[model samples]
Target chain A: MNDAFSQLHPAASFAFFVAVITLTMLYMHPVLLIISLAAAAGYVCILKGARHFGKTLIYLVPFLIFMSVLNALFNHAGVTPLFYLSNGNAVTKEALTFGFYASVMLSAVILWFECFNVVMTSDKLLCLFGRLSPSVSLLLSMALRFVPKFGRKIRSIDAARAQIGQGSAQGGFIRRVKNSMKVLSVTLTWALESSLTAANSMKSRGYGAARRTSFSLYRFTVRDAVTMVLCAFAVGVTAACVVSGGIYARYYPSVIISGFGGIPALGMAAFALLCFLPQLFDAKEALVWRRLRSAI
Target chain B: MPQTVKKSRVTVTLTVIVLSAAAIAVETWLWSSRKYYLTSVIIILLAMLPFFARFEGRRPQVREIVLLAVMTAFAVAGRVAFYWAPQFKPVCAIVILTAAAFNAEAGFITGAAAGLISNMFFGQGPWTPWQMFGFGLVGFFAGVLFGGREVKTVPMLVYGFFSVLIIYGVLLDTGSLFMYSQEVSLKALLAMYASGFTFNLIHASGTVVFLLLLQKPVLSKLRRIKIKYGMLQ
Candidate 1:
């Protein structure tokens, strides 16, 4: 109903991402991986809708299976051997489990990044780094904007070339490739000349003559502050647990996972809470909106 | 102005040297300790920080920043254009051309930016840092070898071949090794390299093809723009 998490302070949103992604990569416990994957998928579905989730799955499922099988084929480092490949490497349970873990971790990271790309827009990145390093931030934001602009320009160039009977998709594979290179050369020239004008315009506006001040729309609200503190506390708890071997796991030589209890269980709970914080906020906002509408 | 420019150059050179040494030391420690995930993250951040600091201190002109952004965009667009072919992208060629035309720092920024922004389409994972490092090094070497000079076709082609190998064969393979094993072994390393040889070959050939076709025109056009705008001087 309400997607208010996206409106949080950029620092809050960015810190959430940095914390979750780092933990997802570092904490290899299967339970943690599963929890992260579920939360990441849930967040992505909420942000981009169900159709995008379906598309992600279409690409991700086969990739996960492929990685698992590849590892099973090549890595033979476990106590329990399932089978022997033709290349003489024994497929072990540990290898298979490790592959599953790796794929889950990889996909979870990727999904979180998808959410990041949607929520942490280029302007946020600029705002985050603009004060500390204006030039680098400018380059980052410009690069982000230019990517889509260049994509459109390439399409227009291709279309125009097609009208002249010299398009990239004209003939055999080689011919098409050569034609594409031609299109690329034309685009390169155009991009260079246009960038010069853009630069000159910035210079005329007194760019680099003094310290640049940027206008920001983001404000750290009370809600954002609460979210930031909650996130930091959760992340700190999880990191301490991980560092103290509370959620320790081993795959090679044997799949021995530490039993969940005490600090380890607490760590897992904190991590799950941290991962689901945005979703929980969104759901709460939706419920409040629905109640308000009913009262109205 | 000239004296300050010279002084900034010296500072940049010193920073790069010190950073490289620190990177090697950290890498040795990482390999010895096998803290692959955490340590590699630190190392990657370390690898990228000095370039940003160098740029901040030198304060590149607006035109140079714009040019770097455009070049990075072009490199990304090139990758998108050839998406039909796996591992066959013109990014390496464009990076080399940028390096040869501009200085190493600009080249590194372009290459790193291209690797990063392109991942927005290709998907990000642990492979990202290695990819960034590979492209950045390719650009760095090209700049060191032929910055502001006329790049001969034969030598440029050779460099293109080797750069792609380093990217796919060495850097990406190392990333794969880390992903697969907690501890590194020579056998695993060799096996990974052997398995990726064909993909690396295809990537290298693509670089050679693009470099042969795009080098002269791209380099000449960039040089003209640089001179016309009084950029990166």
Candidate 2:
């Protein structure tokens, strides 16, 4: 997980994900969808390795197909009917194409999100939010910390219950439910009580004092600046193209894809570059590592 | 400090209204652009902002912040614990109880935060905002309805059932339509709802069951903490 892109400032990586995911959701053009899906797949494969990528695709592809078929079944619009369902609704080619396009967009968005989760860890999120509101960020950080703690407590409580011959795993459904409830109740009381103590400790330490500064490990470097600039440029180019109808598409009476060569191609290329920037960074890092090894 | 809080509240309200109006305008203008999910995500984010803004303006105490964090974490843990049981998460029930014990604002924050943080483990996607919105609304309405009251088990279970079924279930199901549809129509929306009905029933039933089991002891504990600490009055 030593990807160069993720090593950038949290804001830089977060902005990139926002741009790519927004574009993926907004664009219905077939070429753009394919480009996004390919870039997302490349990023995921590089980020999580090939085997993980294959596993995700195995689950995702079927979902994509199912969604597309479901869309076609539900929606009976447009000209150029491909076939008719038993309910006498015409299955239009336009609807089917649109369905597939939507599915690709969804899959691309999902894959990009996978990359996002890997890159944007909890501390990164806290850092980003800390800049906005320290209170909210503190809450988020505490919640993040407490999730694991609470989980461990729940397990311990369950174990204690089992030790006392009151295991939730034993007995009928009602009894099991009651036993688990007892476990949850004890855990809840402990959480609330301990959290109050934690609050007191913070108060003793002057938590709400004026200008209470929080520490963050992330710092914006030269590399982050360059990555942000490139992402902004790509986003600007594609947004202009989309706004000006250069990458226009329609799927109603018929499937129409206009602005083929000039602006549309440029937009798609920009989008591809934007979407694949992480992979590019990873590749460059790998190349540098290899060169260093050779010199050594 | 009170004046500053009032001023900030006004500013937050204005900002939220203006942002919501702009979002709606863009959604309408881009009606044929097939960016339903994008606009919806923007709207959802905008909707959550005011709650955070208010919380920030209040200069809340450490106890309040810690309580919110603990509640959010517990809800997330509940979801994780029930991961193997599809649609059987105690998250909704926990959220409802949180709202009932605290204020609507607290409930909203806990539910929304839990939705987000839990997804950090479950994997996030286009559906994250919708889930956040759904859970937030469930918590909010529960707080509005039963906050600071001794909620009986039967009523709590009933509310839990319907809130999950309607608020969370409908919001998520509708989100799927926006995500997966090129052109939304009544027929298509109905189909989507119908397809999701079984899953929604399971989720709602799970919520009811959790609420039924958890109502008395959880509420009593929350009441004890609230009185003992004088929290979030």
Q: Considering every candidate listed, which one attains the maximal TM-score? A: 2
CAPRI tier for the interface of model 2:
high
lDDT of 1 by residue, A1-296 (tens): 23688889999999899889978877778989999999999999889998989999999999999978877876788999988878888899999998888888888988998898888876776788889998877877787788888788888999999998889989889889788878878888898899889989999999999999899999888988898899899989987887787778888789889947899989999999999998899888889999999999
Clash count, one per candidate: 0, 0
**lDDT by residue for model 2 (B117-214), tens:** 89888987778889988999999999999998767777778889899999999899989888777677887788889999999999999998888777
Best by DockQ: 2
| Window of ten residues with lowest summed lDDT in model 1 chain A | A1-10
Off by over 4 Å in 2: A171-173, A290-296, B1-11, B30-32
* Number of the predicted model whose lDDT against the real structure is largest: 2
Clash pairs, model 1 backbone = none
Instruction: Give iRMSD, candidate 2.
Output: 1.2
Model 1 misplaced stretches (Cα beyond 4 Å) = A80-93, A151-183, B1-35, B180-183
In order, what are the TM-scores of chain A for the candidates? 0.83, 0.92
lDDT for model 2: 0.86
